[model samples]
Target: MLDRIANIIVELKAVTKEAKSLARKEILYKDELKKIKLENVALRGQNATIIKERDQAIKERDQAFNNLPLKDNPDNRKVKELLFANKIVCQQRDQALQELSIKREELLKSLQEAKIAKKDRDISLSNLDEVISKLEAYQNICQEVKSKISQGKRVDADLLIEYAERLLFEEELGSTSERKLDYLENSYMFTDQASINRSLLDR
Candidate 1:
């Protein structure tokens, strides 16, 4: 019975360790989602600014073209030259507007992708929250079992701990290690667990 109690304690420790890891991963994912959202907003703003500038350029080009005298006159050469210059300016403005349109389209696509990513992040965060809550509840149950053990109670702590361990494993906490690292690196708010652990150890 003592051996069983010891095993349960060990299993509880492992579950708590995994819970910590999952919490860290959840934080990283949340941070990354925030960054993606911010980038998406910035890109949208840039697209709007580019569109406004393109429209202004088009209006100015049209006004310039309209101001030019296209009809043949006494100063035919000057008129022709002005018309030719106006055409070149209009062409250049049109090209710039086309490029801006293409850029705006690309930004829009990127924003859409970011939105999808944010949704996925939110889902993952929700799952993590659920897992964390379950883990906390299990931790409390383990504490109760410890109290029972201390009081010379005959609770099946071993079976309870084993069930909790299975629950932890069922959550698939280890699967997010790579994803956590990826988001940690890509996220705007930098977080380094190794550095944090080292600092804590140093203290």
Candidate 2:
């Protein structure tokens, strides 16, 4: 009977360990999802700005084309020269606008894919059950600690140690996540062909 009881206790410990591991994974996933959402919002803002620039480019190109005289009157050399110059400028603007359109399409596709991935992740998180209990337990522990601290009782060494570990883990995780996000954003900047074209046009 004692051997059987010992085996049950061991099994329980294993289960508890697995639960803790799952809880940690859940927390990490939540943080990652938050980061992804923030990036998506930023991407949307960029897309809006790109669209505005593209519209402006189109408008300028149209204005130049409209200003060009249909018939270059050779007798009026100055007028012919002005019209020819405007035509070249209009062509250049049109080419830049076409390139911007292609880049915008690619960005839209990427944004759509990201949205799908986020939706799938959200569904997965919603189906998860065990993490809620673990989170609640953590919150309860925090509340208890606060209550004890308020009542003038010194926090036990073990409790303080656990809190310290949590703080260290959070600090490390935050630092690493920010570094990773920064690198990813920087990498994307290099691939932003539309932004480069806009810069060139502005110059």
**Which 10-residue window of candidate 1 scores lowest in summed lDDT?**
181-190
| Model 1 misplaced regions, further than 4 Å | 1-76, 155-158, 169-203
Clashing pairs in 2: none
Write one digit per residue (lDDT tens) for candidate 2, span 1-203. 23443454455456666656766766676666567657666665766666566567656755765677777524476557655765765676566557656655765675676566567656555533333433433344455556755866544434334433453344342324354334223323433566644533543
Model 1 agreement with the true structure over 56-173: per-residue lDDT tens digits: 7657755765676766233666558666766766676666557666765766676677567667756765665666655655555556556755866554333454446755667563
Q: How accurate is candidate 2 locally (lDDT)?
A: 0.53
Candidate 1: TM-score? 0.44
TM-score leader: 1
lDDT against the true structure, per candidate, is 0.57, 0.53
**Cα distance off (Å), candidate 1, residue 30:** 16
Model 2 per-residue lDDT at 155: 44
User: Number of backbone collisions per candidate, in order?
Assistant: 0, 0
